[model samples]
Target: MSQLQVSASPHIHNGSSTPTIMRDVVIALVPAIIASGIIFGPRALLLIAVTVAACVISEYLSRKILKRSNSIRDLTAVITGILLALNLPVSLPLWMAALGGVIAIVIVKQFFGGIGQNFVNPAIAARIILLMSFASQMSDWVVPFEYSQRIDVTTTATYLSGAESSLPSLIDMFLGVRSGSLGETCGLALLLGGAYLIFRKVISPLIPTVFIGTVALLSFLLGGNPLYHVLAGGLLLGAIFMATDYTTSPVTRNGKIIFAVGCGVITVAIRFFAALPEGVSYAILLMNILVPLIENLTIPKTFGREVKQREN
Candidate 1:
């Protein structure tokens, strides 16, 4: 007779590996990358390259020093690098961008036991850190394509900065003609990337739908322009990508709904009442921290486990 063997949970196989899933995510992000390059020029691509190189090298060095198996091949570091870059302003200094990458990989990711064990999304955390540490550079928004033209005015303010008198048209906002972060400017590209992820089964539409719906409804109720609120900041980017991180988001359907709703509510509250112009990153980070408790409350009970009484 053949010997019996035992293994961990997840006995079933889905035939999807970490590298394959990360590859799909990278593919989905390509449209956003292209849009950012067009809107912000070649400097945008150079920033991405610098940040990615920083993240990859940091991961390699950290793993070597820690005596752990190398995980750079899994491509989580690459995704982290790209997401971090997307959240940053195009005019941000390259050294600062590289510093954010190191913080994402070495501190937030590997420090917490690497990929699956991270408490929050590394890219989001690093972006927040950079925003706090280098407020001026992080908030500096340069006019798109200004490097090519001899324009007297090169700096511009984001739509969310209470510049209603100079707001861009909805068409321009959707087509990446606005002043904002590298990736968050283009609603069209983000939606395309999000759709690809949903179609490829790389992510579920549940979190994004609930999060955006909640924000839009609240914004309408509060006498704000719902469409503008949805498109002005990082709401779409966070809802579709960062908020849906597998390790940081809830596992059960009900838990996901609760998590997303919480994120939306907090985001709207901050945007409406708080001093900050944007709230998506903080909302997602707070919700990521609560995922464990949400999962505990929402996880389904095993079959037949609650029906029997034991005798001592």
Candidate 2:
């Protein structure tokens, strides 16, 4: 007689793997990458190309020097490169952008034992490093298609250009016709990319939906425009991409909700009360540091298990 095999209940397994999900993420990022290039001109494209090449090359050399298995094929380095580029200004020096890529893929990402083992979001970590290293360069943004004999330092394009005004036009913001980060300006493009991710089932809506909804609701209550809130800065990018990092974010549904809500609260607080204009990066980075605690606090109840009360 043959013994029946017992499984851990997920019994259903598929051909889906880490590489598959990373590919889907890359596809989702294409629309925004192209939009940024079209809007910001060659500089944007140049930054993307340079950052990506730097990341891939850095990863290759780092692995070779360390005698580790080749990791550039996993596409994590590509995603990190793209994301880091999106977080940067078009006016940054190519060398600095390349440095950001090195920090992203090598220091923050690989030094800690590659993708899934990293404690923080690599792009955000690299961004923070760059921001701290070169504050002026990081803040310098140029208008879309602004190529001239003499470069100007004027702030020509910014979503928060007129904070004194009651509100900015939501339509303009959503249509990617505003001034901001290269890829973050186009709310519509980000949403389309996010929708693609959702359709591909690479990410759970629990995090993005709950996170964005919390920000929207709070901003509305604070007399801010809800749609504009969704369209501004890196909100969409953070909600859809950064907050959903498999290594740094929560795994279970409840943990995801809490982590996202925490992101929303911190983001709103920073936007409204803090000195910085936008808070998505800091918020996600902060929450990335909290994933373990969130997981411990919100683990799913097993079948026929009693709920444990919080000890206060």
Candidate 3:
């Protein structure tokens, strides 16, 4: 009746595809992007557009030059662009932002075999590169509309960088009326997006939950304000978005928890003592590099065997 067909190991097809998942991630980012526009002004839109275009172009050109199939349709480049734009200051020059996109796509993503083969998140790695290359531009913060009346300047310090007494109220930070990176400023918007991902089953809740909980719990035990730690800077954005990247994170449930906890610990240590104010980028990047190790250590046991016995 029917002929037998041969295929790869993942013969069972799921409804999900690369483009679909990337589309969902883009949808989840919309609220944060809109919130950035409201708080940071029209320039936010320009930066986003610039970076997105740059990334798409870079991906297309890289594929052509490498004689590889064009992967732009998959939208991983698009997500990387959006993430990079959100991490940058609105005041950054368009060219610098575009350059960051190129680095992300060319040096990081494609060079490492593209997509899932990369050892780190392209956007996070690009942000760190940009930060190192343009520290002054990267750290420059624009005053949000809500804070316009209080501050008579174009630029101000971020929450972690500012004096402890002058930090925005927990409410203001939560609502995203404070000054910071375009996307990371709005806690409510990020949470909304994060919840959407969790609802759609695009991402597991375990990594985000453990990552954020570890940060809060550790902060409290170390005499730091837990709420402020959770709401401030890019902690929420990183924990939910960047830290949970499937290619860069652990697969097993136990491995994911360990990866997340490691991220939290590094993040807290950096924020508390490092010269830089925010540590999400580096923390997530470092954990991404160690994901293989984490997975190896936390591999699940056979169904009928003891955990230790399975390992042996």
Candidate 4:
């Protein structure tokens, strides 16, 4: 006779390790990276390299100091770097980009017990911090390649911040021929990457589809251009990449729907009524804080537990 061993409940191996998942996300982001290069020129690539290096070095140093096993191999830090860079203006100084990476990997991520334990999305939080701290640099979006000149001040106003009539055609915005953040400008590239993630089963379509649909419906109701709203700003990037984060997003299907809708509503409200032209990042951050409450309300009850108690 052999004694039985009692252990934790996650007894099955799904074979989806953290490194593998992060790698898949990295692969999915390639199209957006290429689009950024085409739209923003070589500076975009340099910024990405600096930010990624900063994140990797920050994670290594933090873990070494904290006496924890190194986490760079997991590649969460790489994802953080990429996402942070994408959210930033291409003209931002590499040093500032590096600072944002440190804040993301060290403060927001590792200090809070690292990846899975983070309260909000690390990249989003870091980007918001950089935006608040360095408003001028963060807002300095260069004109798109098609209309750019060899000017001293390369910065120009984003289309979303100006009147609708003053903006580029929906086609230009969709094709990423206008000025905006490196990642958020290219709707077509983002959709391609997002589709790959969905096909790879790396992410579900529910949150993104519902989130975008909600935004579209709200824009229509509010007499705004639904297509423009969907194609412009950071809506697609946030909905597809940041909002669907596993640790920060809800686990239940109903919870995900509610979370997505809540993000969409807040985003539309901010865009329509507030001073900010775009609200996807803030909306996702706010919704991420409420994920726990949403999960509690939506998590399914165990089978027969309620019935057994009622019979007793």
Candidate 5:
């Protein structure tokens, strides 16, 4: 038999490690983090701190127990913490957020084979788990400080629906006004973060661009303004943060477009027809399960194979 060379892929490394990418994600999330803290008060920082600390600790302990070489230096735990914090309501108790972090890092992430091997997006899974476990606490939303000092908080469904009577101004919505989860409130910040990710080459534009466009087009056709749909709820957050998860998302360009479109369609369907107000999280999670199928269908054509076909 003729000798053939076979080895691992990704032969080219940009001098970037898993931890570097994770760290970039953390840096990208900062604008939103600061905006959230300003809008939601000091508790936002406290919640973020606890969640990050808990995730790191849980990851360390899990790796220790499993006797695996510790990879906590990868900053994945920090990313998970920030992501979990972004999905949480501003009023959630500190302990609950920490619990979510633990589930995200220890259970969903490490237990499933660490960063690249996890079957689902850990932060989204943790968010869903928290919602299931603490429905009331998870649904709590406080009005922005602009409204009052009393923090007249209310428990409502997620933000995809019009459950909240007082809609934030378009300007405020773009500026991270209104009230909801920490990173979720600021559409502008998410955009900035998304742009940063794009600039850093951490994520491709296909997923987020397609995801956002699908939702915008669909919503516009159904009588909603495109800009309004884009600015509302966690569309920005989920499209950029949750949908573009490296491990769970498609690797092929065509597959990414399909994944993004599927996310937008599911999100709109859930928002328009379903009882649940927010669908981005669920939509992304649903698409996460379809990545393999999408990649299979959208596999890139071999360059020389087409030449052979033409000759034939």
Candidate 6:
């Protein structure tokens, strides 16, 4: 008789690894990176490089100090770095950008146990921390080259910042000739990146579709320009990338919908009623905290388990 051998769960392997998945994510983000470099100039690339270096170094040092296995090889630190940089202004001080990267890797990621163990997305957490700590600096938006010809100003308010008098046309917004963060300005690049991720199967479209759909529907119902809302600020970037982080988002289909709808509602509320003009980061952070609850409620019952009926 053959010897009986039983091991741990996840016996079936689909041949996907953390590094492989992260590589795909990096590939998807390349277009956005190129667009940022083109729109924001060489300084944008420099900031991204600085943040990426900072995150990589921070992860290396933190892991060494903590006596934990090195995880930078997994490429998560790189992704975190890129995402954090994209969330920042191109003119932000390099030191501040480096500090944000350190906070993301050392505090947000490693302090919590690293990688999939993190409670919230490290980039989102870092961006929020920087925004709260340096409100003025974070709010400074740079006008792209194409838009500079139309306006005589170097800096301008974001489209969602209630500067209605200077709002760009929908075509310009879609083409990324506006004032915003490094990567959030270009809706076209973000959409292309999102499509790549979806095609590569790196992420599911459920969360992004539901999240953007909810926002559009709510904006339309609330007498706001649905297209403008969809194209403005960091909505596309957040919906496509940050909000869909696997560790911070729900796993079940129904749970994803609930989480996305919640994000949309909170985003609209903050944008329309609260003082904050941009709410994507906050919306995602709030929903990340509720992922555990969402998963608990949505997980399916075990196969072959007997159903229990409640007593009348």
Query: What's model 3's TM-score?
Result: 0.90
Please report, in order, the local distance difference test score of every candidate based on alpha carbons: 0.89, 0.84, 0.88, 0.88, 0.84, 0.88
How displaced is residue 21 in candidate 5, in Å?
A: 1.3
Q: Estimate each model's TM-score.
A: 0.93, 0.91, 0.90, 0.92, 0.90, 0.92
lDDT of 2 by residue, 12-76 (tens): 98778887889999999999999898878888989999999999999999889888999888888
Name model 5 segments beyond 4 Å from true: 1-11, 146-166, 305-312
Q: Which stretches of candidate 4 lie over 4 Å from their true place?
A: 1-12, 146-158, 306-312
lDDT of 1 by residue, 1-312 (tens): 999999998999899999999998899889999999998999899999999999999999999999999999999999999999999988889999999999999999999899899999999999999988998788877677674542222223245544567788878888878778899989999999999999989999999999999999998898877888888889889998899898999989999999999999999998888877589999999999999999999999888666667888
The per-prediction CA RMSD against the true structure, in angstroms, equals 2.7, 4.1, 4.0, 2.8, 3.6, 3.1
Q: For model 6, how does the per-residue alpha-carbon lDDT over 240-305 read when each residue is reduced to its tens digit? A: 999999899999999999999999999988887777758889999999999999999999878998
Model 3 clash pairs? none
- Predicted model with the maximum lDDT: 1
Question: lDDT at 267 for candidate 6?
Answer: 90
Q: List model 3 lDDT by residue over 1-312, tens digit each.
A: 899999888888788998999999999999999999999888899999999999999999999999999899999999999999999888788999999999999999999999899999999999999988988788777778752333332323246543559788989999987777889989999999999999889999999999999988988887788888899878998988999998999999999989999999998888778877677889999999999999999897678765554564
In model 3, the runs with Cα more than 4 Å from the true position are 1-12, 146-158, 161-164, 303-312
Poorest stretch of ten by lDDT in candidate 4: 149-158
Clash pairs detected, candidate 2: none
Tens digits of per-residue lDDT for model 4, 129-248: 998899878877787784354223333334544368777898998999887888988999999999999998999999999999999999889888888889888899999999989999
Output the better candidate (1/2) by lDDT: 1
